[model samples]
Target: MKGSDPKPQSYEQLPLQFQLYDCSAGQSDCSQCRAVPEEYGCVWCSGTCVYNQSCTSVPADTCPPPQITQVSERCSVLSSSQMTCPTPAVTPEVKVKGVWFQLDNVRVHYETIKGKSFTYYPNPEFFPLNREAPDAPYRFKPGGVIAVEGQHLTRAISRQEVKARLGDRECEVKTLDNTHLYCEPPEIQPLSVDDRSELPCLKVFMGNLEVELGRVQYDSDSLSVVPLAAQISLAAGAAVIILSVLVVILMYRRKSKQALRDYKKVLLQLETLEINVGDQCRKEFTVASFPPF
Candidate 1:
């Protein structure tokens, strides 16, 4: 009862006989689709068909380009130039002292090892006893200055441009220039008091980039200082060994003397018992001798 001639279908259908037109063919006036210029975009409209869409077109300059006023920091275009193009890219190389070098190849001349000392042994080379005051602190010290070489280091105009690091720790840059950079090594906390790990090589940095100047190692002949505590421990160990030996010897001598005393006491008891038995035997044999006398 509710069925009305099942409402006529409303699905989209294409005409059986139709010709396809190239929308991008740039046809200005065509029977199928005509391209028309608009203020914002080029549009194609079909008067006969319901199909219509935006069309691509080469924009014609109705007015001249904007005038160049202030100079751009990157590119400076000349007034006579027709086409506006970008400026050339920045080169990676920098010039210094007539020599050209890649920014990464910049070298920092610095003396890495001012002095080094061992935790136990002290060497005059690392800590010259003659050069230091008589009351100078123990040979083992924490930090020292790193003297940079090269005259070009002075070229760095500001401290912000130059930076330095030792291993993962950033060091304080004292003096910096094109030729030299003076820096104090970071105060590193070793895992243990006897830590003898090699000092990390000094890294000279320019802003965020790391400079590849090769690794710097400490001179092996430098002063090698040892901790005073380690020396004292060695002396204490020797004293303990000597004391143990003396104690063992004294104990052995004491045992020997006690054994000699015991042996002498046993001999004396035996002699006394023998004398008492002789007296008792004489008493027993001399019975009833009064009558005979």
Candidate 2:
């Protein structure tokens, strides 16, 4: 057994082989944790990464993210002297722990009611909304429900505080519980599996509580007509407007031409009346010269 070392190497200084397993610490979600090679001795357990041997509760050589109840807390009282918010007078998780993180747009400080949780809080100076957080793989299309599973999900449902978004579009939340949240994305432009374009990551928020759910992926089966339909409607509207304007201009031109004809007809009649009156006056005013002859 060794007690102390006069010099120790930093983690970066470790050998390439030793560095392989240490990379597991960077994984924040279950899928990523599980993706780490098992030979690394890393196992995803209870929403955290640990050596497979450390997770004695699960089956031997097994790692799984256990199903645990999730909740968000809002405490009305704060102790300025203690610089801490008192835990609500509610049922707390049995093995309670807390982690500070900035998940997407919202700053988060979640108490893990279960096991060891990593802290990912942002330093306000370097914080930009949803910039650095990794995303989980979530396949979805408009009108289809996407389920969000995590801690404190039930609390969100009961409080009617759950909201979700993909990119800038809102995802209408349908139902939620402790371990799962069901939401439907808004209609959008068509996307296909073969299309190598990028879309926004999934984000869930409730007031100050925020969580980055994952990233959306399109598949062959998924397609949206909203954008195409909108374009068609806009084109139709423009055509109708143009037709109406043309009709109005044609009617105005016709009325102007009719008025010009009417004016010319009245002037001609006046000229004829003047000519007849002058002739009658001349005959009346003529002397008896013609009679003398």
> Clash pairs of candidate 2?
70-151, 70-152, 71-152, 97-112, 101-121, 154-177, 154-178
TM-score of the candidate numbered 1? Answer: 0.26
Q: What is the C-alpha RMSD of each candidate to the true structure, in Å?
A: 25.4, 23.6
Which residue runs of candidate 2 sit more than 4 Å off their true CA positions?
A: 1-136, 156-159, 189-197, 224-293
lDDT of model 1 at residue 82? 33
- Tens digits of per-residue lDDT, candidate 2, 178-260, equal 66667777656333223333656667765555565446765436663468889999999999999999999999999999999
Output the TM-score of candidate 2.
Answer: 0.30
Model 1 stretches with alpha carbons more than 4 Å out:
1-89, 92-144, 151-156, 186-199, 220-293
lDDT for residue 254 in candidate 1, whole number 0-100: 100
Q: Rate the local accuracy (lDDT) of all candidates.
A: 0.48, 0.59
List TM-score per model, in order. Answer: 0.26, 0.30
